[model samples]
Target chain A: MEWLLEANTAGHKFALMAIAILLFAVVMGGILFAVDRPKRVPTWVVVAGFLGPTLLLLVVGLVYPALSTIRGSFYDKTGDEFIGLDNYARIFTDDGFQRVLLNTALWVVLVPLVTTALGLVYAYLVDRTRFESLAKALVFLPMAISMVGAGVIWRFVYEFRPDQPGVNQIGLLNQLLVLVGIEPQQFLLTAPANTLYLIVVMIWIQAGFAMTVLSAAIKAIPDDVVEAARLDGVGGFQMFRYVTVPSIRPALVVVLTTIAIVTLKVFDVVRTMTGGNFGTSVVANEFYTQAFRQFNFGLGAALAVLLFVLVVPIIAYNVRQLRLSEEIR
Target chain B: MTTTTPVMAPVPGEADTRGRVHSRAERAQKRLTSRTASVAAIVIAVLWTVPTFGLLLTSFRPELDIRRSGWWSMFTDPQFTVDNYNQVLYGGGTDFATLFVNSLVITLPSVVIPITLALLAAYAFAWIPFKGRSVLFVAVFALQIVPLQVTLIPLLSLYVDSGLAGSFWTVWLSHSMFALPLAIFLLHNFMREIPPSLVEAARMDGAGHVKIFFQVLLPLLTPAIAAFGVFQFLWVWNDLLVSLTFASSPDTVPLTVRLADMVGSRGSDWYLLAAGAFVAMVVPLIVFVALQRFFVRGLLAGSVKG
Candidate 1:
């Protein structure tokens, strides 16, 4: 039993994993077995058997914790004193947190807008081109890898060394700079531009998602609509601007809002690339830093609540757009 | 690739009109922007591809050469070795091998547990006639908007109080809980697409709900299951935050956490970092490439569902 809880060794971990699975199977199986005898069990009994565990887990895991964190936000740093709204006041007043909020704004605004635009253009370019899948796959490959993996890849590309007679630049970006007679710069260490550099990594990873969705939306455009637009002398970019963009407006909103939500919660990139240093800390990363590293419980809970607050409007807009599109359909 | 609206093939006589319209538009596109479009596409592809290629090439280079010159030097210099991979995998004190195993242990159950639970819940939401079914379904769907950040601190405290803080169980349970809403929503959408008549026919034959779920629906839900499975697999495997919060210890750390740690401590060691990054990347990359169809389907279904 103790080893099941504390799986320190490789063998113990695997054994413990087996037990966990087995335990889950038995519990689920027991419920099903008891309820499968139809005509004996009530409908609520079967419903409970099917949905009870999930509802219980959700209430315990998501709802309870979220409400508790919101409550914790009004407390003092130690989480023992009930200091009302002080944590929220400090978050709004502090200079470091102001930069965190501003940086988050930049990320939420930039990554989605640029990534969606790039994806739209790319999807349009290769819509019916030769080697379409292969071309799309090249950009889409980054979406497959971890953000940490992406951070490492881009870190090497941005790697800098002193530009002296004996030193050769290893990072490709710096090497390019040196070839044009510019000195090497530490891309990650600089403050404002560093945030942009980190955002580029996100755009690189997410362009595939936007491209994929938008490409499908482009293809789903009724051929007659395109033909009608063409008959109206809407050739070249006009066809795209009028026919393509309007047709995929719902998809465009979905991609933008989805990417915005993802970017808002982007902890991995900032954590991996800069570890939220040099003015790169966003709300998610700062939440982790305050809670885990500094052990500032109430402040961390406030940052976490701040993140939840920011996500509400975006999700509301998304749902409204979804409803509108569904109504039109 | 699955277009929701079917494309109607042009009738034989109308093909000429449609074809001419397309060709004229295409020719206009060609004459106006062929060169620029080609250049832009090529530039985007090159920019997207070269960084990963450079890192992959660097991973195969010797340590001294990697430190001395750019990976582009390989075209002129042409030196390569697997020693970096060797050192990263089996290197004393790095122990990426154990981290890799931890990733597998963490990911497999995280994928399986949530999926099974979501399948059952989705079935009930889609098929079972119950009081408050629509309200319950809508509640689960709405829960998808609860960002995992809000839940982490208290969830951590809850796990610590339960004495499961640093264990695999904590990671598994947290991931399972976090994944349920989206999983239930997606799987429910898929399940509802199945004709209710199938379940009705089974019910007419005196089959129970359990029998109908197992015999009629589970087979049909394979693609949906696979779709969410691939999504969850890549998610759990590539995850850093959840594992970093729950299982940061060496005994339970996955590849991403360990790799992120290496970047912080060994930021300058390109050889080890490059190879270690690939070690973290290889599984999800393979899964993505192989299951890309399901992944694309899942992504499209998850987002654009009008």
Candidate 2:
């Protein structure tokens, strides 16, 4: 058992993986075997066999912890003293935290809108073109890599070498500046601007998602509608504006709200690229910093609650849009 | 390309109408093939790829060369080596190979456990005659909005009390827990799409719910399973926050956590960082390319139809 927990050797890792899978198989197989036999088994027994593990795990893991964290938001840093609303108040009033809120707002507003716009245009341009699949794949490749990996790649792109003789700039952006005889700047060190740079990495990732979804929606448009629009002499920008845009309105809404929800909870890009320094910390990263690093569990819980609150309206709008789209379908 | 070109000539009857149609087709083709549109498409693709290509180029350069010059310089002064990858994977201080194994270990159980559990639960919700099924399913679906951040601290303390704090078990359990809501929702959606008459025919044959699920529904649900499987695989393998929170021991940290630590501890080591980043990315890239059809199907099903 101890080796199962602490082992690092290849043999031990594989052994533990096997043990874990075998344990799950035994437990699940036992439950199924018990339920498989015994003709005319009661409804209660069947329900228990099916929903028992899932309900228990969800209750223990998600429901209980979420409720406890919300409760903890009212307490002090140590979580021992009950200080009502102080943590939430500090989030609203503190200067540094104000910047966090502002940055979070910027990220939520900018990333989704920009990514969706780019995705729509790119999807429209590349639709039915030669090499459409390959072109889309190039954009979508970023989505496959982890955010931390994307962060590393972009961090190198944003790397700032000193401006001096014989010190050729290594980062692509800075190198371009040097080639054009302009001074190379610190891309990740400048406040606010650094936030935009980090947001660019996210846009790079999510634009693929937006494009894929919108392209499907674009293809789903009825052929007769397009043919009629063409007969009516609508083409070029007008066709995209009138025919394609309205046809994919539901998908557009879904992409926008989904990306907004994701952006609100983004942590890795900020953590990896800048470690949330230089006024670049959003609510999610700040929550981790407060809760885990700073050990301010109360404040962390507050930030988490804040993120939840912010996500609610976006989700509500998404659900409404989905319902509308389903009705149309 | 042939499809887009207006190859037909104007007909004798209704010559003006035919000309109008031909001109529309020609204009559409021109719009598509216009230099500006082609240039814009190529520019976007190049911009999106160049950053990653630069890092990939640096990954093969010698450490000294990477630090002293731009990756683009290699085109003129072409030099390359695999030493950076060698050091990043097996060097003295950074044991990323072990972390790579840990990532695999953490990801497999995480993907498998939730998927298995969610399948059973989805079947119950979709097929089994049970009370409160709709309410329970809705509650589970709604739980997707509860960001994992809200649950991290209490869950961490729970793991601490159980003495599973730094084990792979904690990471597996957390990921499984976090994934269940979405998995159940997605799987349940897929399960409902299965025709009721098939389930009824199985029921008519005196088959039990368990038998019908295995024989009838599971086979039909393969595509959905593949879709969600790819999703959960990527989610768990690429996760950093949950792994960082639970798997703190050097033995248990996954590749993303180790890579993040390297960035924090040694921010300037471009050669090693570049190679390490690629090492983290390679599995997912391969999986994405190979399973791309199912991956996109899963994405569209999960998000577009949610």
Candidate 3:
């Protein structure tokens, strides 16, 4: 508040504001450029329409900031120095950043696998059930809530003050633990377990997605094949394994890879719950930490780039899976 | 453990013995699914629902009670209260109604700008023979995966630089950019499905491109419009990141961000938080339910490739 008020008085913010508008206008203009077809709008007019807005926006809003972030990553914390590879080196060697990386690894791997598996099973079970709509809707309700909303809801579910006298636990898990004649621990503050707690949020949000995609796939499992399986006396579990799973394999890949890609970008829950404290840091959290909290723009940009890099493979796989499915059709 | 025996059973015509085993295995499978499968489905449905149920209950409980006890405790004690509802709806100075008015002010324009731009861009991509259309569509689609958070800092910086960070135009523009890719992809698939002959007929009738799109195409795209509108509404409404980063001015922030502050200040105020969360969720839920009927049949209308 103080700085903003002072900055306003000095009129520095105005210049920055103009630059922002110009950036958007240029980007929109660039989009117009690409959009221009010579016959309809006249090539020059089309080019001006597209390039004028898109380039302005991209340069000032997106491209410049991205480049600035990359540049900042090469510089020191205050965005002044020029140190190459040092920030990247710190990410690999530093204990705090390493833990963040590991937590992210566990999250990216486990959440997607579990959520997808859960969705697959749910999809199969509810495929043609009497209550399929109701069941799927229940699972997907969380999807409509922001990640932040889910995080706040789960925070209470995992909330803990120390198990001291008169604290009275609010976290449901801890409350249950106390009932079983065991000690209640600060679940969010606990080392490795906290990561599990955070991962559950992703699973909750994504399982519905998995279920929706996989259920649709399950429904699309050519009725004839299912009938053939029935004639072969492959009922129940066998039918699912041989007939259904194989049929939905492409959709399964899409769901799994989508979840993996989303997992790479997990942020809100960590930020909301523990604020990236304890040992539950992930790449997104680390990116924020380095960039915003610690003001280490260089390391932060490195983390963001690493996230982008790590995500490309899964994204490619997902796109590949989609293209393959399109081709098969 | 049981898999190897059945799969490795003798060829079907080998012996009656093998036949009996096969029939037994088949019967076993039937029994396994009918009896046991129901149990697994129920368990998963129940497990998946717990946290949401917790949120539902927390919304109804009194503020003090929420801070004092686990949300699950409502089952045992079953204390019915509207205190939270009261506090959330009409209690404080900046009540839910006021914040919701703010949310609406922000949400309406945000939804309109993207849909308008996306529809034009999507039409151009789908029909108006353009250069690099596929690449452009692909690029747009790819941007959908960029973490909104990653965009936030730069977006905020850009907004700050332009002096529009706190304005409705700033948030609306930000939302439009973020939403363009998905909207274009979905709408393009739909527009392509419109049968090129219809477009060609309009073109032959001396209809301009914009006229054909709005007068001819738009009406036919009701289901698509409704579907995308519902999604966009839900997305913008539920969105916290952008609403927080770009639209946090006193006049502009939406319910999701306001809900966060309520949680921060009134951490112990369950009544406020629950009511607020519920309020934020209500419109999206309504949108889904109303449009949900059109949802499945809308885009996934045709037999899409599995």
* Off by more than 4 A, model 2: B1-33
DockQ of each: 0.62, 0.55, 0.21
Candidate 1 vs 3: which has more lDDT: 1
Sorted on TM-score, best first, the list reads: 1, 2, 3
TM (B chain), model 1:
0.92
Candidate 1 per-residue lDDT over residues B1-306, each given as its tens digit:
332323334354343455554556666565668568878888999999999999999999999999899999999999989999889998986778888889989998999999999999999999999999999998899898888989998999999998888889999999999999999999988998999899999999999999999999999999899999999999999999999999997789999998999999999999999999999999999998888888888888899882
Which window of 10 residues has the lowest lDDT sum in candidate 1 chain B?
Answer: B1-10
lDDT of 3 by residue, A180-251 (tens): 978987778789988898898889888877887777777766667876676566666677788888888887
State the weakest 10-residue window (summed lDDT) of model 3 chain A. Answer: A1-10
TM-score of each: 0.96, 0.96, 0.84
lDDT of 2 by residue, B175-233 (tens): 99999999999898899899999999988998988898899999999989998999999
Candidate 2 lDDT by residue in tens digits, A199-308:
99999989989998998888788878987897787667788998999999999999999999999999999999999999899999999999999999999999999998
Question: What lDDT is reached at residue A185 by model 1?
Answer: 97
Q: TM-score winner between 2 and 3, please give it.
A: 2
Ten contiguous residues minimizing lDDT sum, candidate 2 chain B: B1-10
> Candidate 3, what DockQ?
0.21
Most accurate candidate by lDDT: 1
Q: After superposition, how far is residue A325 of candidate 1 from its true place, in Å?
A: 2.2
Error of 3 at A144 (Å): 1.4
